[model samples]
Target: MQKRVKYFLIRLHYLTVNSNHERLHQDREIIYGKRGLRQYWEITTDKETISDDSTWLVMTKIPKINYKKVGKIYQIRAWVEYGFKQSKSELCWADFRVTNYAQIEKWWQLVMSAYLMVSLHSDSFNPMVTPVSEKFQQHDWWNERKGWKNILNNLRLIIKPYLSFNIISRWLKVFPIPQLSLGLPRLINLMNEFDCLRYFVYFWDNFYYSSA
Candidate 1:
């Protein structure tokens, strides 16, 4: 007693608008798939040539939807696919080997958290770690790192110090408290170990960049 509304993409060879009807930019026309599946379409074509790959042959069963809506919906599909791609390839969405549901959930949460961090930021905030300014963008490293991959790497360096307590503790071994062993040492050596506070303040740019 009920049905689902959907769109089916069919090649142009098996479908064309009714010849008796005067052609318009967008017309509700009959469509026939290669396998003979029939549906109505909001037909649109290129401004110059209607044939070849210029035709966007999207068919749908939705009532009251226009050609513009169809075009926009398909355009949005591309971005959705791109997000999934970044989630998989870039964020290692499937890289975790957790056996239990809770472990898998946390792993995916961490993965998506990273993906969300990068995705939510705008290109205006380029290099990511630092706010984008005309003077800042003029650096030599900035020229080579005008891409998202470099932005992610820069973000890691910016946050590394705050996350390095465990690693720093391993290096120092023990003073009972992690802060006393790791944090106090770094704070004490801030000036002596690295020359000046200028290098400590802008450690990523001056110290890390120089070392790299």
Candidate 2:
């Protein structure tokens, strides 16, 4: 019976998610378990694609609701999974190796913060800039779907000098003037390469001239 249902679904025309001709079958069943008898809504898609040759079958203990609502909820879940994949793959969300609880928590917070910043500036990181170069633009992160990591790396390189200065001054009460001199030039060159010097200079000038 299950095999017949599967074959019928695969043979149906317009088996995609957007198909209006698709059908949903819902029934209540007492699923046996070690705890006790549990009732669930066994929602099966008559023409929804699960794989190349199969349809989807979902079981939920939630109260009876519209099938379209269930589908919408599933779609949202898919998007959430996509976000987790992005965080893990592009933001290095799982790259830490700390065993201490506090350190692990702090690392996760930093990673999440960096991910948020990169996502907020995703438009600026586009690889489809005009006057494309064969050598440089070809390897652009946006072009290769690796924009998040590239943005994080670029921001880190540009801000390393200031961050280093802050950390050193916090610990030693004195600024490392020698390191500043060596770092600022390289930082400026990097900003120029990333085409962010104008914005950087603008912000610097504003902060310098602003009355606190």
Candidate 3:
């Protein structure tokens, strides 16, 4: 029975991975582009509204940033504050003040829902849903199909603790992951290749923000 259970667990893991593998890759490409040249933005709130109190941005370069899509910038900021880490390089934390954690929590839910949808449907997991499919039809997490709903529910169960830990950790000043040590050449390369880096970074940001 134990062997059978283990086998079942293994198979279940693969099934989950196979089901969404392709979609992940596609999702990465969709938001980040081929080379990942997308810019990132962060926002923070002070008194009440989301404002320029404390904002940290991880970008390929400042010059390549597009200010047209300001909404996306806020979304990215929410993702970071919620505990998502950079996929590639370390980003300097910009100081910003939020009025309260309550407002950030609300934004987190919306972003989380969007992130799950794209993750399940992107090309990395052999994403096989159609536009007509019920899953692709909406961004609401509760409205997702049974399988996806299960996944999202499980994720939420996991995420809440993670978020709480993150907030506490940041406040207490702990490093969950070690900071990177790159020399001047690599730093210059990061800035010089901002176009590609921005795309990749922004793509990840979109995925991360969608979780809220």
Best by lDDT: 1
| Model 1, total clashes | 0
Model 3, span 1-212: residue lDDT tens: 22211111101011112334421100001123332455433322222332444433334344555432333333344566554443111221222335678955654554555554534543343234322233332435534354433444534533444454445556445433323222433444433421212234435634433343
lDDT by residue (tens digit), candidate 1, 1-212: 34444545422222223446433343344434332334455445444556655445565666666545555455444477885776456667666677998888777777767765654333543233434445433445544354556655544544455466556666666446655575655744532332212223544454232100
Model 3, TM vs. native: 0.20
lDDT of 1 at 37: 35
What lDDT score belongs to each candidate, Candidate 1 first? 0.50, 0.48, 0.36
Question: Backbone clashes in each candidate structure, one number apiece?
Answer: 0, 0, 41
Per-residue lDDT of 21 in model 2: 48
- Model 3: weakest 10-residue lDDT segment is 6-15
Between prediction 1 and prediction 2, the one with superior lDDT is 1
Q: Model 2 scores what on Cα lDDT?
A: 0.48
Query: For residues 52-103, what per-residue lDDT tens digits would candidate 2 score against the true structure?
Result: 3333444554565434444555544457888668765666766768999899
Task: List RMSD in Å for every model shown.
Answer: 13.5, 12.7, 26.0
Q: Of 2 and 3, which scores higher on lDDT?
A: 2
Inter-residue clash pairs, candidate 2: none
Each prediction's TM-score against the native?
0.42, 0.39, 0.20
